[model samples]
Target chain A: MNRHLLAALGLGLIAGPALAADGIGAGLLKSQCIGCHAIAKPENTSLDRLWERKGPDLYYAGSKFNKPWLEKWLQNPVRIRPAGELYARHVKGGTKEDVVDESGMAPHPKLPKADAEAVAEALMALVAPAELVSKGAFKGEKVSMAMGGMFFGKLRGCGACHMAKPGFGGASGAELYTAGERLQGDYIYSYIKNPQQFDPRIWMPTLNLAEPDLQRLTGYILQLGATEAK
Target chain B: MMTNSRQLASTFSLAGLALASCFMLPANAAAADEQYAKAARNYDTYCAQCHGINRNGRGINSRDMSVQPRDHTDAKGMGDIPENEILKVIKEGGLAVNKSVLMPAWGNVMSDTEIREMAAYLRHVCNCGSGK
Candidate 1:
C-alpha cells in the first residue's frame, strides 16, 4: 500500500506542472476561440489559407492587443470591420438589404467579466517573434489633428477605406474613428508598416510610406482616440 | 455501375456543349445585358460603398465624409467629363483628376479590363453620348 501511495504521489508531481501551465484559460481558449480564431501558430503564410480563415488570426494577440482594451472589448463586443474580414464576402451588390444586414460579420459573443479577464490573460500570453516588434517601431510621437488629417485624407488616401469619424471615410476596413481607443500604438505602427506580417491576404495594400510618413500616420491614428474623448 | 458511368459521361458532354455555345455565340442583346449586369455587380463590390447603389452619391459612408461623394446620376455634370477621364479616375483615384482624395487608387486592386467595364457602366448610367 505504501509503495502504491508513493507511485501515485510521483505521478501527481509529474502532471501538476503541466496542468498549472495550461490552466482554465487555455481550456477556455480551446473551447471558445478555436472555432473562429486561429489560436495555434500558423503553419504556412499562404494567401489562399489566409483567405480561408473565418476570423482574424490571434496567434500574435500578445503582440497586437493592448490588454486593457482587449479586456474591455471582450466584455462589450462591437463590430470593427465595416465590411468584415473579407470585404468581398460581406458586401454584396450595393443594395439596401446588404447594407442593412452587414452580411459579412456576425456579432462576437460577449464574455462575462471573469471569462473576459481569463481570455485576455490567455491571449496576452500569445507572442510573436521579437523581430516583428522591433524597437523604435512606435516612439509614441504626437501629431496634430490638422497635419495628420491632411495626410490621412489627401496625401496617403487612408480615408478611402477607413473612417476618421463616424459615418465618414471608407467602409471596408476597421473604423478608424475609434482606433486610438481600440488599438495599441505599437500594433498600429507595425500593422501599417507591413500588414502582410499579420494577415497575408488582407485587402489593405502595403502603402510603402517613408518612415516619417509612417510615424505621422500612426500618430494620427493614436490621436483620433483622444480627439473623440472631447 | 457501367450504366451510371455512361449517364455521367452524357451529362458532362451536355455541359461542355453549353459552355462552348456561350463562347462561340455572336454578341447579342442578352450578352450585352450580361456584361452590364457583371459591371454593375463589380461596381457594387468596389464602388457602391461610397458611390451608392443607385449612383446617387448618398452611400452608407457618405454622411461621415467631409466632401460628398459625386452623384453619378447627375447627367449634366457627367456629360462634360470625358471617357478617358472617367477611366483615369477609376484607375488612379480622385487624386489623379485633382478631385477629392477620399477616392482610393484602384489600379493595384482591379485589372485594366475590370476598370474599362466599370467606365462603360458609368457611361451607361449617366446616359453620356446617348444624345438625350
Candidate 2:
C-alpha cells in the first residue's frame, strides 16, 4: 500500500488541546512531538527547514485548521494532498523518488492515552499567522519570484530532492515545485525543525542548521507557488 | 514349488524395505544437520554475546543495555514482527533508517548476504514466524 495510506491509519491520536493540561501528556509531547513539531510559542522561524518534508506545519495550526477538523485529523488523517509530503526532498521540486515505506506510522507505541489527549489539546491551540494569503489576487509582474523560483528549482538544485518541474526530475520523494499553491509558511517551518518525529525515516538528511539560515530557507521554499511567476 | 516361491517373495520384500529406509534416512538427517549448523554459527557470532548461549536474553552485554533485548524464545513477540522486517533490521542494524538507535547500525558492519543468513538462523533457531 501507499505510504500516505499507511500514515493515515495512525494519525488519529493528534487531536485538539493536546498540550493544555501538561503533566504526563506534556512529557509524551516532549519525547514524541517536539522532535518534529515545535512546543514553544512560535518565534524565530530558524529551525523550519530541517523537517521530514512530509506533512504540513503545525505552528499556527489553530488558525489554519478547524478545531473539529484538527481533532478528527489527529485521530484519523486523510489525504489532503494526494501527491505526498511537502518537504521530502528539501527543495523546490519535492521529488517523488525516495519516499519510503509508510508502515512505520504506528502511534507512539509507548505513549499513554491520557497524554495523547493532552497533546491534542496543545496542538489545537496553535495559531501563528492569522492573516489570509493574497496570491491569485494579482500583485502583477512588478515583483518576480521567478528568479527566486529559478534559483530554487535549478541553481540551488532544490529540485534534486523535491518534486521537479514538469519533466526535469524524478519522484524519489515529496512534490514541492508548486508548494506556494498548497502549504502555509508556519507549517513549512515546523517541518524543518524536526522531521524524524513526523515520520521516523524521511528521505531528507538532518542538516543541523542555525535559526537565521532556517528563516531565509523558509522564505525561499514558501515561494514555490508564487502567483506572479516572472 | 510352493517353498521356492515363498523364499523369493520374502527376499524381494526385505531388500525393498532396506532400500527405502536408506534413501529417506539420509535426506532427513542432512536437512536437520544443515539447519542446525547454520543457526549454530550465527548464534555464536551475532547473537551469543547479547542473547547468551541459551537464547534466554542474558548475553554479557545484556546487563549494560538500557532497553533490554527482546527474548527471542517469546513465541508471541517474535510472531508480531515479519521476517523481512527482521532481515532488514539485521542488515541495517537496529538504528539504521527504520529501527531504534539502541539497536545500533549493522549496515556498515555486516554484509546484506550475511544479514539474510542471520535472519534465516533466527527463523530456524527461534521458530519465530509471522504467525502466532
Candidate 3:
C-alpha cells in the first residue's frame, strides 16, 4: 500500500523476466550445443580427440569469434568450411552424385533471433587462456594487400586450403575471405601460429612461418574483410 | 615373287583380322570412361574451387590467389606435361614439381589409386595423349 513498496514491487517484476530469459538461454545451450559442440573445457587435446569431434571446438568461442558474426551465423547458418570440418567425411567423390552427397552434410541448425542472441551471449563468455589473450598478441599491424596476398598464396600456401577471396582457393577449409569480419584478430594470429592448440586433427598443416611473415599474413586476413566491405 | 592374285588374297585376310581387333576397342574405352568419371567427381569435390568447376583453373577461389591454378583446358600448357608430373603434383602438391606451393599435397588424404585416376582425368581434360 505504501509508495516505496509499490515501486519496489514494479522493479522486481521487470527484473524477474530478464533473469528468467538468461536461465532459459543457459538451458538452451546445454540442450542444443552439447550434442555437437564442446561447450565446456575439453578433456582431451590429442589428435584422436580432434578426429572424434562432430563440430569445431567452441570452448574458446568468446575469444575466437566476433560477436556480430556469431549472432548472425546462429540466426542463419551458412557453410564456413566448404568441405565441412572433417574434409574426408564431408567431401565424397567428384561426380555429380558425389556433389549431391557433399551437399547433404549435416547443416548447422538455425535458431530464432532471441535464442541466437541468448546463445551468442553465452558463447561469448567462454574465453581463451590468459596467455593467448596477453596484450600485444595482435599488435594491430597492417600489411599491404600485395604482401599479404603473396604470403598467403606463395610463401605460406594458405590459399591451398582456405579461400583468400570469395569462391577462390581450396574447398576443404573455411573460406578466409571474410575471416577478418568473422573472427577476432587475436584468435586468427594464435590459430595461424598453431592450429593444433585449438584443434589437433585439423587438416591444415603448420607452415612454421617466420615471425614477420606471420604478422603479414594476419594483417592480410584483416584486410580481406575490409576488401569485402568495399 | 608371288602372283598378283595371291598377293591380293593375303592382303584381304590381314584386313579382316585388323577389323576384328577393332571390336575390342569399345571394352577398353568403357574402362577408360569409368575411370574418367571417377576422376571428374574427385576433381569436383576437391579441386573445383580453385581449379574451377569446368577445370579451366578459374575456380571461384582463384580470384584471390597469388598464383593461378594450372588451367587443365590449356592443351598447350598441359600437353607437354607427363602424366607422372600431374600425378606428382596431385599427390605431392605444386612444390614437389618445382611449382608453387599453393597446391597442397593430397598424399595424406587420397590414395595412390585415386591419384592415378586424377592424373588420367587431367590428361583427359587437357586432351593430351597418354604419356607412354
DockQ of every candidate structure: 0.17, 0.01, 0.10
- Which model, 2 or 3, shows the larger TM-score? 3
lDDT tens digits, residue span B1-132, model 2: 999999999999999999989998999878876866744554544454445455655543344344555667776777777876787666554644354443433444345776776676666556765432
Ranking by DockQ: 1, 3, 2
Model 1 chain B: weakest 10-residue lDDT segment is: B123-132
DockQ of 2: 0.01
lDDT of 2 by residue, A138-182 (tens): 222232356655644433434433543443333333455555444
> Could you arrange the candidates by TM-score from highest to lowest?
1, 3, 2
Chain B TM-scores, listed for every candidate in order, come to 0.72, 0.65, 0.73
- CA displacement after TM-score superposition, residue B66 of candidate 2 (Å): 46
Candidate 2 local lDDT, residue A52: 34
Better of 1 and 2 by lDDT: 1
**Candidate 2 residue runs with Cα over 4 Å from true position:** A1-147, A154-156, A164-170, A197-200, A208-213, A228-230, B1-132
Model 1 iRMS (Å) reads 4.4
Give TM per candidate.
Answer: 0.66, 0.30, 0.60
lDDT of 1 by residue, B1-132 (tens): 999999999999999999888876755656766879867766765677677766887665565577788888888888888888888888887878988777766665567998888888887788776332
